[model samples]
Target: MTRFDIPAPDAAAHAAALERLDALVKPVGALGRLEELAAWLCAASGQVPPPPIERPRVVVFAGDHGVSRLSAYPREVTAAMVRVFLAGKSGVNVLAREVGAGVRVLDIAVDDDLSDVPAEVRAWKVRRGSGSIEAEDALEPGEAARAFEAGRRVADAEVDDGADLLIPGDMGIGNTAVAAALVAAALGVPAEEVVGTGTGVDEAGRARKVAVVRAAVERAGERVSDPFELLTALGSACAAATAGFLVQGAVRGVPVVLDGVFSAAAAVVAAEIAPEAVRWWLAGHRSTEPSQAVALKALGLTPIVDLGLRLGEGSGAVQAIPTLRAARAIIADMGLLADLG
Candidate 1:
């Protein structure tokens, strides 16, 4: 297993940020979660007022899942969407453009050659796609570590390139099935409670998906003790890599905005592996997926929005960027009561 030097968020900076917010010319708690966001950002950046985030980057990890053979969406759609993302034609692209954040579509394991995809997109293929967790281990031996290392390196590269904020998204067919297994195994919850209609599966399909998740969990059993083992047994490459991104974002002290259910699933594994990294994370929105709420509660994060969004390509997270910017603006532009008088 590869080593990760994860550290806790800065407590002194968090305190200073709260003090500054309290001194601002506003009611005791008018800002609500915005104030909390400002303090957390301050802790992340080690700044009292928190610097303006000029460069927000969204990295969408694309892959395919053998479990999709069980009927969530066409597995080929994963590669097709990667091409669309590379062409700047996906929901993530539109939202990222609206927020002035650059988007990078990374290929982890899409089960296709992706020859048509532009050369700029990052490619770190761990495998063509993970095996069906319903019957066997999702990832081969050591593949989980590779997925995680790929994510860590991507996070490092993004941060090194002046990206002040990170958004990790997912693009894979039947990922919700794998995500449910991850959540169920990590939280020790029943699979039926976490599984939901991913994409557009029918009721019968959903039932089958739930059964697959339950079987996957039962197959993994006690081996789920460690985060890596849980991922290898039930997580997709995209998911394992997203977990790495979360870990690396905290390790690098950069704020990470989580997307929908997929990102939350990765966060579950991340929270288990590095409990302190939760401080650097913020839920972008409350996805309609049932597992999303479970994962968020496990990490103790409140979503910035609850608009019933269930899109997976980081759209929800990008939608929340303006709120973060607004929080920063409040701290930077609002006049102090002492100065007003």
Candidate 2:
């Protein structure tokens, strides 16, 4: 089974981390989120002062969803959007430039044939995407394994390219429906709490989304309590890819910045599988998606960037990359008291 390295931080190392952080030439509470960053890095690395980063990597997974068939958005938008990403015109692309991060788009699913896999993408195309999930399971039991290995391959390549961190993203319309089903089943919350107006699905659209999820939850029966079972029931390839990245990342000890609802839902599944994996996931923003607040709370993660964003495509995740870099820069470059005093 896939997993993450989740051992508790050493008590002695914890003390040393506090000592080093206190010496950062400011009042104990002054640095705010930066202090949290330093401590988390310290705890994750089992060191007093975490090293600076170079070659940051962001892996954006673009997959087609079965739910899109029921939704208003057509499937063609996916490929067209991938084109935008390749053009470096998307928000994520712009932010990737800002953070000096390498971006790789992994195609695990799509409704139509995607030929000539773009050089900018890691083409792990899985059968022209999943068939409509409303009529059947999103992915077969074994197919999930194939999709997961694709994500693992992406993680390995990124790490080899000198990536010290991971930012995992997902792109798929009607994915919020998949995410909602996953949350309802995994967290034992009602489907209503998990459902959201994903990507501008107006009030009525969201109500319809909730009804769809409610039906799925009911059909899933007793097994709905198991997170993986739930994922198989309602999750899309994009959601699966994000979850796989989280699992792969934690197992390899890579810190990943999670985008909004879709990525966060993946984090929820991964955290259930590997509790230590939650430590690796940092929320980039609180999504405009209704369930984001509930989902993040369930995972005990607070978004460092609270931009009211609901757009998919990892816009939130890519944006947060700079914050991580900035945190490291302050610690690495700020003059030490011994150097100054």
Best by lDDT: 1
Query: How much lDDT does each candidate structure score?
Result: 0.88, 0.72
For residues 189-210, write the lDDT of model 1, one tens digit per residue.
9998999988978899889988
TM-score (all chains, Cα) for each model: 0.96, 0.90
Tens digit per residue, CA lDDT, model 2, 32-88 = 897777667766667656666667777778877777754668868887777777777
Model 2 pairs in collision: 64-109
For each of the candidates, give the backbone clash count.
0, 1
Tell me each candidate's RMSD, in Å, in order: 1.5, 2.4
Number of the top-ranking candidate, with TM-score as the measure: 1
Error of 1 at 68 (Å): 0.7
Badly placed stretches (over 4 Å) of model 2 are: 1-14, 69-72, 119-123, 335-341
Q: Residue 193 in model 1: shift from native, Å?
A: 0.7
